[model samples]
Target chain A: MSAGTGDSVSLAAAGPILFDLVAVIVREQGRLSEIDGQTGDGDHGVNMGKGFRMAGERLRAQGEFTLPQGLATLGDTLLSDIGGSMGPLYGTFFTDMAEALDDTDRIDAPHFAAMLKAGLAAVQGLGDAKPGDKTLVDVLVPARDAFDAAQREGKSFADSLAVMKAAAEAGLEATRDLVAKVGRASRLGERSRGTLDAGAASCTMILSALADGLVQRLHA
Target chain B: MNRIINDPEQVADDAIRGVLLAYPDILAATDHPRVLRAAKRRGEGKVGIVTGGGSGHEPAFLGFVGAGLCDAVACGEIFASPTAKSFHEAFKAADFGAGVACLYGNYAGDNMNVKMAVKLAAKDGLEVRTVVANDDVASAPRAERDKRRGVAGEIMMWKAAGACSDEGGDLGQVIAVAQKAIDNTGSVGIGLSACTIPAAGKPNFTIAPGMMEVGIGHHGEPGIAVMPVETARGMAGLMMDRILEDQTFASGDDVAVLVSGLGATPVMELYILYSHVDAILRERGITPRHRFVGNYFTSLEMMGASVSVTRLDGELDRLLAHPAHSLGLTVLGR
Candidate 1:
């Protein structure tokens, strides 16, 4: 049931798991913010954690939010609950993903891929940013590309997830050389060139964590 | 990417409690539908002035409610505008009947939400008037500035306008004066740091160290230029230049200047910035009517600064000297 793309995971079973996954994700965001506080603003981790926490609470209160509903809720929550501008950007990603999933009970690999693509597109729409901007897209784009490539090789959903995790790890490291082109840190211009954007770093880390968490849970 | 948070939905609720616990000078209207709060009521007949927005602006909508500025402020969740019901409820709790005036930045959600609140109050026969701070010259030129987004400038607007409303001016007259103050205002900001949203737990945007986004608003929106982060003097120059370009206040013009440290910027740095900014204004021969520097407006610990200059006539200066008894604006006791 917890198989590859196109494999439908029921909301009942996946719902609780997804809710927990979000909890873990929220924790991850908090850690990221703490790290960010050292050089960047200290609120990143807390903000991300806040966004996820709100989403998790909503899920807990109302079990098994449909993919679209859950994603939209996450988006709106990020926009409203998490202060700062990033809320709308990330919130848009989830909102778009959820909108793509409208009325669907479960998502298959292709649908999931489409959803990811939509999420990426939504981020771009909101920020006018790109992968090389030393943004979260550095990891996200590569992960999605790798996942798609693995699918082309007839790999299982799990295998594609592995591919995504690998690509995201590589992307995260790759960011160490990139420069920030958006937000306040970008103002550092050249100074920001060597250091990976805390945002991109944290975003990639989350992708890496997500894949790891999912793989371990699925195997279990 | 791991940190601890209990029930996600309860974060705001819990945070509200934390604020009340930490700052007793403030009284959270946890008792009301909207999170309207203020410094303890002092029973002064000073006209009431209130300001509010989403929760992320923090000490902004709440922190500024005492001592030097406002009487009451209604809070919504982070980045989300409080609903009309919330504003109406806040007015119910905040109005002293001398008159109540609401001040906030110009954002659609806030406008829509607060507008409904005003209408509701008017229907109830409560005299209410409104003023919007459209200070982001980065978003538009002066002619169209009113249509542009309001960012951190609401602080200065409230400071001046709150004074007017706090005096015995009728609601309409007070609102007119506030609107005039807003019209005379011009502002722009630059971001040296990116702040995160607690819910997202990651950066909303990133800037490389030594980099900056000039003309940015508090929400981490893109600015006119992305340049190398420079010395504090250079940063002040950059922000001031944009504001100067965006509005017209000639040399020898008497102006009330607000040098705001968007959260995360300390007063020490703000003073350093003031030195640089003051030098620029002097060079341009602009007469300073009044000047204030502090972290009056913030975006959840984001490191940045927004400069606001409101051209003042005598009427403006006189009203500014009027009184209020908020926890923040206690000096100007009503």
Candidate 2:
């Protein structure tokens, strides 16, 4: 279980990671909606909470879901049940990540990096948003790139996860200064500034929770 | 939230259920529960017209589903876009050999959902075209017309496209007519109060008792200006002035006008506003060829109204005169 043992947590051991992500979304639901209320319609948190809660319930019912299995369930719930822009975006994200790690029981640094890249691609493929569009892509692109950079620099999986979380937080913070260019807030133009994007904020929370869960499970 | 509903989270679902019960003759449920298709199918070669938006704008995204109108509608959550799957389902429901035309507003969620839905439909070998309505004049400058929001004017777009489809136009022709309708239209909303999403349990935004937000959006998005509430005449003049400024309505030009109450506004007030609107149009020598004044489009229980004016040509005039049947709007003939 040493950092350099090339060790990996079993996919079954990673199910709680999605549970952690769901908890994070549920806790921040009000804050996320308040942020959205500043510019766009304030339903981001409600929709995210509803989707994540549904996924959590399904996962709990399964009792022994694997990482990819849990991710697939969550993605399916969001894609099919949730009705918002964030649903398909994050649904595709988790679905792609699940597919990327489907064949792997060992979640090594390279494999994790590949998963992050796949999730990022899935989000960008569905949304026309770029990094500066003040949308979830801003957090996702940077977080994915940071993880890849840490991996390329020969960092441990734990250290790469730390880097990803930090980058995601910073990306989320940067959205406060950005004028929305893609979502409903984009209609506000300059009025969209001075507020954090609800999507980016929720995305950062999910990414951070995910990173923390992975780090704790690295030695399990 | 002091409202009628079975479940707070299921407000949209319950409302849709009620819509189905109330209008079974005009509406039919598709494979996807969120998608409501017209009961009467179009002719064999006629294009299928489709539109969708978030719920709470009743008689809008769903109420417009009927013969000679939108063939199908993808119903979203209270104020959220419908899932891409729902949009795809609507496409399937509307597709009948002839290609489908998706006529909807220019909102980010709708745009993304429709984009994915089109991709999904393409996988199923269904051809779907789209015409996005961006007629809210105050939402963006003329230079950024594509960035504007589509408000009540979306009804006009659907009407024109549906008429085109009923006339046996192809998908491209329907899309073209819908686009023309929106492009020639300008809309502006004035909000006297805010509406609450039942789930949220409170209004998303606020307007002071004596103040009104001019150019407000459907979902309580901030408007261009906040001013003291004015009489119906004054409000009509302000809204019409903004709409007229956005587009040129020349002397003797035929125009179709729609004055829609923003949910809680009474029909009496809407007609009062429309009287001023009609007077202003007459003073400017802009003939009101077709006029619709009612709660045609609404935003939950927000107390407000929107004015939409579409400059019409011979083709558009014909489309306006064409027959339509829907819960929200119905026209017999010239």
Candidate 3:
């Protein structure tokens, strides 16, 4: 999204990119909290931001490593980060992604898809959600599935993952109709129906960022 | 909005810092985000306990972390279960030769997240066992108690777990002891007015004035029924009657009772509800072994309270009576 290429970007490029991404999530958490506040206990964006800021600082200090290195950094940062619910959900995403792409300098489409799958499985393992739980999975689950579908249709890595971004966007949009079945929003019953889930929105942002990075790299 | 917070996104971090600020002597921050544990694992050769969950449940997941209770608490953001990595970090900080027990409320996110964390830790050769508190009777029927939400009943579970650890029991024994408490517990909650989350700048719900929702959850769960507002006495009777419908407690049964405030409920009102609760239980000839009243598990300042009754055997009474040193609860003095 910075218009700077995301392909084969050095850890230097990746570090700042990671920082920016983390910062966005951190900042967006407040906005997310507001949406959830309509039906949840609030504190969405704040915790989300907190978790990412922790990851960002780690990246700033030690993010100059390889892709796997950066991912492991993110994983460790996420695991220990205490901001809130997103800590593990996002943390699992990074940790699984790290494991999936252990040390690749730049990942192609197949590996990228594998990373996405692993991240999805990790989140599912945490049982933080199903597709309509109105949490991050609402966005991530669909995005991952769409990426898989597009890849199966023989779309190029760049084109297929591009669909992932759209899927994530659509997933985030779909949250507006989902009455929360979990977390604080579930308590509000009908009141929860009107708002888009904060986690879902953030999940879309994360996937979209990854898509932006991949498209830049693959196209270039 | 009207929240007593610095920024919307910084709430959990700021509040976590405040927690460290409040209990400098007992809890210490870890390298991970938002995680705090006892400054040191017991050099005392005692078993260690680790408990945590989403932020905002205050005095709950973290406040219960101290000498006689949990050695570590992995604080996640409010309402979101903590990640597995954070949960594993807590296990390392708290594990003693006696093994570690991961205790928490049985919410879906926390359950799955902590499960992954504990699994990772076990791979590292740490003896880890998982125990969840699921005691809210209002969320499901008696035949389906396992599927109920873990509301105010978590307190009793933590208390029992901490007490077992304090008595120097092995981790398995501690978990077994906690299992007993969880098996005997039942809880019900009600909401008079919906709560407002600070950052969101709007109420989480909009219940009409003079109307109350019955069987509301700790995180502001939807109630089974919402109707005209009932008096404290009527509300107490309603909650008690519903809870007792399963005959969880019989005449002459000794019990440990909890009257918990859901975020915004005033203590004065909680006491009012308690008086009626005690009266209702008394009419059924139940003897309260102990009683606790206060805001334990919250819903981001929602106005509600839950009543929980755990039929107490002697072991549970002792476990409840063990010395506790936490931020919100510290009568143990040790």
RMSD vs true structure, all candidates: 8.7, 1.9, 4.2
Candidate 1 C-alpha lDDT tens digits along A1-220: 4532234443333334446547666657656755454434455666677668777888778765654666677777765555344565676677787777665655556766887899888777656468798777888799899999998999877678788888887887787687666654554445566565566666665556545544544443
Evaluate model 3: give its TM-score.
Answer: 0.84
Best by TM-score: 2
Q: Kindly indicate the candidate among 2 and 3 with the higher lDDT.
A: 2
Error of 3 at B202 (Å): 3.9
Evaluate model 1: give its lDDT.
Answer: 0.68
lDDT of 2 by residue, A29-136 (tens): 999888988887788888998999999999889888878888999998888888678878888989999999977776777778788889989988887898899998
- The interface root-mean-square deviations, each candidate in sequence, come to 7.8, 1.3, 3.2
Q: What TM-scores do the predictions have?
A: 0.60, 0.96, 0.84
* Candidate 3 chain B weakest ten by summed lDDT: B196-205
Question: What DockQ would candidate 2 receive versus the native complex?
Answer: 0.70
Q: List lDDT for all candidates, in order.
A: 0.68, 0.88, 0.76
Q: Candidate 2, after superposition: displacement of residue B18 in Å?
A: 0.9
Instruction: Choose 2 or 3, whichever is better by DockQ.
Output: 2
* CAPRI grade, predicted model 1: incorrect
